[model samples]
Target chain A: MYSILDNSLTLRTQLFSIVGSILLLLIIINLIRREYLKEGYSLLWLLMGGLVLIFSLFNELLFSFSNFIGIDYAPAALFLVLIIGLMLISMHFSVAISKHEKRIKELAQENALLKSMLNKKERKRKTSKK
Target chain B: MTKKSVCIIIPAYNEEKSISSVISSIRKISRRYDVIVINDGSDDKTKEVTEQTGTGILNLSFNLGIGGAVQTGLKYALAKDYDIAVQVDADGQHDPRHIPQLIADLDSGTDMVIGSRFINKTNYKASFLRRLGITIFSNLILFTCGKKIFDSTSGYRVFNKKTIAFLVRNYPIDFPEPESIVKLLRNGFVIKETPVEMNRRATGESSVTPLKALYFMASISVAILIESMKKY
Candidate 1:
C-alpha cells in the first residue's frame, strides 16, 4: 500500500492525476448535457475516466497489480492497459463505420432510385399531354 | 404462355461517349425490349444522350458505385414487374448481342446467367493482373462455394424476377459482382454461365488500376468469404 504521504506518490503527482481525470469527466458530462455527445457513445469514455480516477486515488494499486501479474515495470502495465483500451475503442469505431457505410449506401441508392422515378413520371406526363 | 418482359440495365459512370452506341445496338436487336440507363452520377452528358435516344433513364443523384447503381436498376425492375433484367456496362464492353442468349437461359430455368469471357476461349485479351485476379477469385469461389464460376468478375448478367427481388435487398455496395454470386448460390438460387465475347473499351480506362486492384481483390475476397460462411 502506498499513499501521497509515502515517497512513491508525491502530493503534486496525486493532485495532477486526480485533476486530469476529473476534468475529463466534467468535459464529457458537459458534452452530453449539451447534446454534443450521445449517451450511447459516452459509456466507454466514462469508463475510461472512472478507471483513471481510481488509479489516481489509489496510487499504489497499479504498481501492486503489475507486480501481481509479474510485470517487471509498473509503467509498462499502464502502457499495456492504454494500448488495449485504444485498440478496443478503434475496433468499436470500425464497427460503427461499417454500419454507417451500409446505411449511407442504402440511402444514396434510394435517393437515386427516387429521383429517376420522378424523372420518368414527369416525362410520361409530358408525352401524354402531346 | 405470356410473352416475357425484359429491361436492359446499363450502369454508366461518366461514360457518355459509348453509351449512345450501346443503347442503339440493343435497340437494333429489338425495340420491344426496354433499356434503362442508370447514369451513376456521371459528370457528363449521359442522361441527356440517353434521353435523346428515347430510352428509359434513371439518373442517380450521386455516384453510389456500381453495386448501388445495379441494385437501383433491380429495384426498378421489380417495381415495374419486368420478368427479366439484364445488366450491361455502358462502356461498350459487354456485347448486347449475347443478351438474348442470357435471357433465354434465365427463361429456361436458371435464376441468373453470367456472360463469361473466359468460358470458351474467346478473343478477349485480358491483362496478366486481370487474369490473375480472375483465376484466384474463381478458385476461391469454387473452394468456398463448391461451384465453379469461370468469370466471377463479369458484370454482364441476366437476372430473373425472383433473383432481382433478392438482389435489390442483398446486393453488396462495393465490388459486388463476385460477392453476389456466392450470396445468391448460398441462398439456393440457380446460377449458370455461357460464353460471350467482350469488345474492347470504346472510351475511358479500366476501373481497376494496379493500386486499386489490390483493394478490389481484398475487399471482394473478404466479402465473398463472409457471404459463403453466413448461415441463412
Candidate 2:
C-alpha cells in the first residue's frame, strides 16, 4: 500500500509483484486477442490476476496468510503455490492433448485403410466389367 | 440376384476370437461387398485372423480407440469412392444380414442409416451408469445437433456417399456416433435410423465399463459441444 522505492527487502518483493502482475495482465490480453485459450480455462487466469491484485493492494493479510502457512516471505510462498498449481493444471492439459493426438492418429490410419479398400474394389469392378 | 457394393468397416481390438465369425457372416451375405477390419494396435491375433479371412485389413500402429478406428474406415470409403459404407462391430452382437436393409435405405437417397435396437424392442441392457450416460449424452446431442438421436453410441450404421465424403473431410475421432451426426447435420447432411435387431455380444466383454462410461460421456459431451460451437 505504501509508495515504492523503499530500502526494505519487502519493497523489493513488492516491486517484483508489480512486475509479475503486469506480465500476467499482458498475457491475458494477448490470449483474448488471439482466441487461443477458451473462456472456460481463462477463469484460472482471472483468478490469478485477482489474487495478485489482492496481494499488491493489501500486503498485511497476505503476509499473515503466508506466516500461517509457515513461509518466511508471503510473496515467495504465493509464487510457489502458483507454480505448483500451474504444474498440476499443465499436466491435466497435457493428458487431454495426448488423448486428442491419439484420436487424430487413429482417424488418419482409418482413412488410409478406407482408401486401400476402395482401390481394391475399383480393381475388381474393372476386371469383372472387362 | 442383384449385387450391391457395400463396405463394412469393423473396428477391432484384441478381437481374435470373433473376427473370423464376424467376417465370415458378412461374406456369406454380401460376397461382392468389401470388408475392412481396422486392427487398433491389438496385441492379439486379431490382425492374423483378419488377414487369414482374406479381408482388407488396416493395422494401426497403436490403440486408437473405437472412434479412431471407425473414422479410419470412413476415410477409406470416401477415398476409394465406395457406393456406401456400413459400420459393423467386430464383436458378434450386430447382425451382418441387416446390413442390406441399411444399404438399401442409403440407396433410396438416405444420407446415413442407423440400426436402432430400441425401435421395436428394448432388449439391450447395460449397467445403469451406461444407460444414464447414454440418456444424458443423447439429450445433449439433441440440444446441440437439433435432432432426436435414439441411439447416440451405436456403431452399426450405414453411410452414403454424402455422409462418407463429409466424414472423410471432418470426422469426430472421440465419441463419434452421436457427435458425428451433429457434425454431419451441421454441414447440411441428412441421417436416418432403421429398426434392426442386435443380439447379445457373442464374445468378449464390453469396452465401456461403468467408470469408463462416465468418463467417456463427459469427455465426449465436452468435445461435441466445443466442436459444434466452432462450426459457425
Candidate 3:
C-alpha cells in the first residue's frame, strides 16, 4: 500500500511540473511572437521559463540545488527563485518608468512653449496686417 | 544696462475664483513683465478666465503637479530668451506688487531671489503643525547649505537667465520648494531672499493637509540630504 501511494505522488509531481513549465514557455513565446512584449523584456521571461523547464525535466538537479541552498523542500527552492526574478523585473520596470516620466515632462514643457510662440507669431501677423 | 524682459509665471490648478484678479493685478503692475498663466489641467474655468484676461496661457494636457507646472514655465522662459522669470501664486497669496522688489534683488547679480514672508513678518500665520514642518525644513537647509532661508516653503520666487536655464533642465518634481534651494546652493548659484507681504488666500483650500504635511516633511528632508550629497 505504501509503495503504491509513493509512486502516485511522484507521478503527480512530475506531471504538474511538466504542464506548468510548458504553459509558461508557451505563453512567453506567444507574447514575443505577437509583439506584445519587447525583445529586451522578453529575454528575462524566456530565461525564467527555460530555467523552470530545465529544473522540471531534471528533478534530481532541483533536489540537489534545494539541498545546497539548505531548503528542505525542492519546490520551495523554485518559489524562492521565482520571487527573486519577480523582484528584479519590478526593479527594472521602476527604472524604465522614471526615465519615461522625465521624458514626458520635457515633452509637455516643449509643447506648451511651442504653442505660446506660435500664438505670439500669429498675433504679430494679425496686427501687421491691420 | 538695458531692461531685462520679465515673464510672470502663474501656476494655477482649479483656481478660477482668484485667477482673473491675479492676472489683472499683474497687468496693473506694468506691461514690463509679460504674464503667462499655466492652467495646470484645471477642471474649473481657469483657462477660460485667464483667456478673458488676455494673458498667455500654457494649458497643460494633464495634471503634472506644481513642480511640473513651474518647470514648464521655466522651459518657456528659456526658449523665449527672457532674461528673468518670476513665479507668482494664482491663489493671490503672493502680492504681485512685491515682484519689483524681487527683481531689484536679482539686479544685484544674484541668480535667484525668493520673496519671504518670515523675513519681516506681518499677520501671515501658518498653522502650528505646518509652521513646525517649515521650521524644521528651514533649519535642515540652513545646516546643510550654511545659508539661512527664513521661508523655504514660499513658492514666490524669481529666477535669472542662468538659474532659469539650469532649473529648466533639472528641477525637483515633488516637494520642490525647499529642495530647490539646496540644488541651487550645490550648483554654486547665488540666492537672496527679500521681505514680501503675503496675503491670506481669499478663496480655494490649500492642497497640503496634516497628513500631507508629514509626508512633505519626510520627503523634503530626504531630498535635501540626497541633493547635499551630490557633487554638483
What is the C-alpha lDDT profile of model 1 across B67-106, one tens digit per residue?
A: 9899989988998999999999999999888988888877
lDDT (Cα, tens digit) per residue for candidate 3, span B1-232: 7988999999999999999999888888898899888988899999898898888899888888899999998887887899999999999999999988899989656999999988886778888877898788889888899999989989999999999999987899987898799999878899899998888897967777889888878888888888889875
Model 3 chain B worst lDDT run, 10 consecutive residues: B204-213
Candidate order (TM-score): 1, 3, 2
Clashes of 3: 0
Query: DockQ rank, highest first?
Result: 1, 3, 2
Clashes of each: 0, 4, 0
lDDT by residue (A1-130, candidate 2, tens digit) is 3323222347677778778887887898689779987876677776777677667766776766667777765556677767876876687689878878966785568565655567679989999999
Of the two candidates 2 and 3, the one with more favorable DockQ, higher being better, is: 3
Docking class of 1: medium
**A1-130: candidate 1 lDDT, tens digit per residue:** 4333234557797799899989999998999999999898888888888887888888688778777777766656666777787788788889989999888877877787788778778989999999
Error of 3 at B188 (Å): 1.0
Q: What is the lDDT of residue A78 in candidate 3?
A: 78
Query: Each predicted model: what fraction of the native A–B Cα contacts (within 8 Å) does it retain?
Result: 0.96, 0.39, 0.61
| lDDT (tens digit, per residue) of candidate 2 on B40-132 | 889999988988988888887788788778877777776677878899998898999898778877755568888887566667776688668
Instruction: Flag clash pairs in model 3.
Output: none
Q: What 10-residue stretch in candidate 2 chain B is worst by lDDT?
A: B118-127
